[model samples]
Target: MAERVAGILLAAGSGSRLGQPKALVELGGETLAQRGVALLQDGGADPVILVTGAVPVTIPEALAVHNPDWSTGMGSSLATGLHALAETDAEAAVVALADQPLVGAEAVRRLIAAYAGGASVAVAAYDGKPRNPVLIARGHWPAVIELATGDTGARAFLRARPGLVTQVECGDTGSPDDVDTAEDLARVRGVATVRSEEKS
Candidate 1:
């Protein structure tokens, strides 16, 4: 199968809860944005687009393009990213958030695999709850674009179009844990420390 999927990383949030730029926050020696990009790269997605707005003036050169309207909401960023994908010949796209460091390369692989297996949309069902890091087939892109508004993302739209989605299970607890607050960051650090200790 030829590569037909693209990766879209939404990184333009105000970070009001985090009190700083969450995308630039360091995690496991890499920024959240970098980690998100790496996941897409590792998953074999071509031409990943990183959308930024709230604080995206200095996005790294590695990201194909950064949307400055990120402050409007995830929906605007999603619309922008999806539109960018439309320009490409991609059959689908894997949409993710920069704050989700736990959505590592393995998770992305599973998402793409599920979508490739015929799911019009493949979303991560972490802890039995569907969230970001979803794979949207070309046929479902319009719905995704239509349902996005304000800060709202594709969850509601995905829910409305239940017939097209196939949920995939992810093994990591962090896969669902987005770093939105100071406590969330602390928790992530703690988990990383524990994992490091176990490895040693």
Candidate 2:
């Protein structure tokens, strides 16, 4: 049997810049947190975990884990998420951002495919630039936790080992835009609404 990979959604940001918690932000008639969980599950991640910091969220489909050090930065949330995955049988984790609603399941599947093909670190790339929904093998979680601090998350660790990463192009799958401000929210909501309507 193939090894399992968990999906970790970082939703702990206070969203102070956006005037509300990004997790609760609505898009396409669903909260960002809800949408994130669905995307991860649909993309083949087993036992999806959501790391919330600024405020507690209750999403029935996901195992919600709180990061008490959320105020410190994204690194804390990443650590908390990894810690939550420690007890699971997951061989790796696919990290996704709660605010990035446009990042679709196809990107995640691609990252998983890379990991299954022997890549220890897989990252979604937009136009050749590294983006969100990165896949981190279990072997690197400890080091990632050590380097993850403030808003850096796993960036510093990933940067230190560039040769190990497998970048998968996902420009055709979806956008990596995140809603960090009211203007950004409005823009993303508009886009989401249009897409939802088209699907309906």
Candidate 3:
């Protein structure tokens, strides 16, 4: 049997620059939080989880875990998601950002594949640069949680332990572009439109 890998979406950002909570932001008629869950689910993750902060979000598709210290940043949300999963038997978890809606499910699949291939840590890379949808094995959760302080999320731990991360090439899969501002969102939406038209 395949190991159970949980999917975690970090949607706690207030998106002060984007003018609203990123999780609540809309793209193609779906909230970022909702779309993020579907991305994980479609990527073959079981029991997808969305970490909510800065705003109240209730998505039927995901188990929303509230981070009371969300104001501190992504680190708290990452810790929150890991703690929530510690209760379960999942061997690993795929962490993603809500603002990066353009990241494809294929990235998640590749990270999971890396994890299955004996890599305890996997990061999706676009155009040779490591990006979102990182995969971490359960054994490394404690170290990750300890380093996950402030807005850095897993970055601190990942940087401290570069040898553990397996960069999965996913540039062909999708973009890790962030919707941090209105202009960025517009650009991402435009890219999405082009991709959709291409698919059709």
Task: Give per-residue CA lDDT, model 1, range 1-200, as digits (tens).
Answer: 56588889888887899998887898878788888888888877877888877665344534545666666788888998998889889998889888878766777788888877778789888777788688988877888899998877887788788887788877673456779999999998777667768779
Candidate with better lDDT, 1 vs 2: 2
lDDT of 2 by residue, 140-186 (tens): 99999999999999899999999999999999988999899999999
How would the candidate models be sorted by lDDT, starting from the highest? Answer: 2, 3, 1
Q: Tell me the number of clashing residue pairs for each predicted model.
A: 0, 1, 0
Alpha-carbon lDDT of model 2: 0.94
User: Clash pairs of candidate 3?
Assistant: none
Runs of candidate 1 exceeding 4 Å displacement: 57-61, 172-174, 197-200
Candidate whose lDDT is highest: 2
Q: Go through the candidates in order and give the C-alpha RMSD of each one to the true structure.
A: 2.0, 0.8, 0.7
Off by over 4 Å in 2: none
**Superposition error at 172 for model 1 (Å):** 4.3
CA deviation > 4 Å runs, candidate 3: none
